[model samples]
Target: MPINSFISLFGRSPIGPMQQHIAKAHECAANLVPFFEAVMAEDWVKVEQVQQEMARLEREADKLKKSVRLSLPKSLFLPVARTDLLELLSVQDKVANRAKDIAGLMLGRQMAIPQTLHAPMRAYVQRTVDASAQALKAMNELDELLEAGFGGREAALVERLVEELEDIEHDTDVMQIGVRQQLFKLEKDLAPVDVMFLYKIIEWIGDVADRAERVGNRLEQLLAR
Candidate 1:
């Protein structure tokens, strides 16, 4: 079947708007990899390039978010509550917003990643991105779950995906702690201002994953209802 026909059959699917948000959120999250890479390499040009790209993606996500919100009719009915769907959309948008914040800070400060903290910092970024990806995967299953009426095998599968997202988020938290410790060790050697911004950067990076986990948790709640 043509994809459009298939989509038309499920015209009321909330998954459509949710997936549009997720796609942009994932794009925002994925850009962080190259953003950090450029920062680590001390290549200001490349860093600016990636930062611009992140900003563009963020703008795109914001537009889609507005579109989704405005397009949702007050009388429209679905398998899930409208408020739950709105909450889920809000949480998903946060993921993209946090990514934009990270990129903006990196560009504004041009903060250098210390060699000792590089490995742990990169690990944190990767894990956080992984968590967001896992959350997206769970959101992707929403259509199937709705088709299954939120019961039986499909429900179980989505629950498992949520569990994996939580696990990855926990691991990112650990990675953040280790990275902070390494940063602490180098604090005395670095300028106070640089150290302060570096700490902020670390905190913001972790926020990305934190928000992603919230997305999963919100979805889990929706499933429970």
Candidate 2:
């Protein structure tokens, strides 16, 4: 089949579906800001609303992931291995999954962000979201990389994006450490269970950035091949 005809028939190139999945995942990550803000205000209603939105976006991203996997042709020729593409999709999907996990944890406990940790927590969330955004941008370049046969300026562009993603993730890690220190300092003032759950929430929020870094690593592996 002609390339354009095959795409028209098959819906889109593999990267297209993958991009949609990452975009949805990014949407889920984007909600973390408002969700955390709501939590800070002790506005359970707004927190629940944001949680629902994250859940909805996560479910939609899951559907897109399934569709992409099922529709991906086994015999279709491409510049990269099918396994690599699948791995990339799986990693990207985890970004959304982590976002939902964070949301669920917050709602389950009605977790409140301590005033001392508010600024650091928000910084952590923003950095994680930024990492996810950069990863998505790198994923967006996959089609272009394919067109360039995975070399030249396109590869250089993605390489730089991956570097930026790594840097953002590192910043989030620092923020996580700082937040943990603050949490520990304030732990004495809170109920023991609240302290435990707060730690869990902070760890899970950091996972979002870790997952985003994994996505970038997967793309780097693809570039290597």
Candidate 3:
């Protein structure tokens, strides 16, 4: 390649595209709020509509991830380790994947949460989505981290944001416990198979939050390098 062409290719920062990908991931996760609502409303039309949109967003994120990987420079002159950036991208990808999984399984089964569990389950899903949102907020600072060479004030701000993400994850954990307890009390009245899936849905909600926190964890790791 010509020297000018090489410079232009390598000069393009990967940070912006990485941030775009996470925003899409979080958007998919955030849609779960409406998804669960439609399920509670027993509005199959709306539920299917929302799930298709989320699936679309996830696909868009996947395309961006692939583009980032292919265009990312392999040069040692990059600000962050190329491998570390790739790993972070992989973790970020899972947030969308997990969200897609929840939508697919729930929609496929036409699953319904018991009326009594609806309120808490909705709250649980919102908080879980909040985790993904927090991850995105922290990730938006990647350009600043690069500008500051990943240190000092910009780095401290990112650390604090990650800490907030951790706290949100903890709240989701407690909420999960409360939800499971409520479901346990009502399980006998519900179909045994439905109860089983309800428990799995609850666990999967927690997994969304868990994967979001890992995005924060990856940011912290990058700082350590």
Judging by lDDT, tell me the better candidate of 1 and 2. 2
> Candidate 3: minimum summed lDDT over ten consecutive residues — where?
1-10
lDDT of 2 by residue, 1-225 (tens): 444555676556888889999999999998999999999999999999999999999999999999999988885666667788888899999999999999998898888777888888888999999999999999999888887778999999999999999999999999999999999889889999999988988898899999999999998998898
Q: Comparing candidate 2 with candidate 3, which one achieves the higher lDDT? A: 3
Tens-digit lDDT string for candidate 3 (1-225): 433343366587788899999999999999999999999999999999999999999999999999999988786355578899999999999999999999999999999888888889988999999999999999999887877777999999999999999999999999999999999999879999988998898999999999999999999998898
Residue 36's lDDT within candidate 3 is 94
- Sorted on TM-score, highest at the top, how do the candidates line up? 2, 3, 1
For model 1, the run of ten residues with the poorest summed lDDT: 1-10
Residues 170-197, candidate 1, lDDT per residue (tens digit)? 9988988898889888988999999998
Query: For each candidate, how many residue pairs have backbone atoms clashing (under 3 Å)?
Result: 0, 0, 0
Residue 133 C-alpha lDDT in model 3: 97
| 1 or 2, greater by TM-score | 2
TM-scores for all candidates: the values are 0.93, 0.95, 0.94
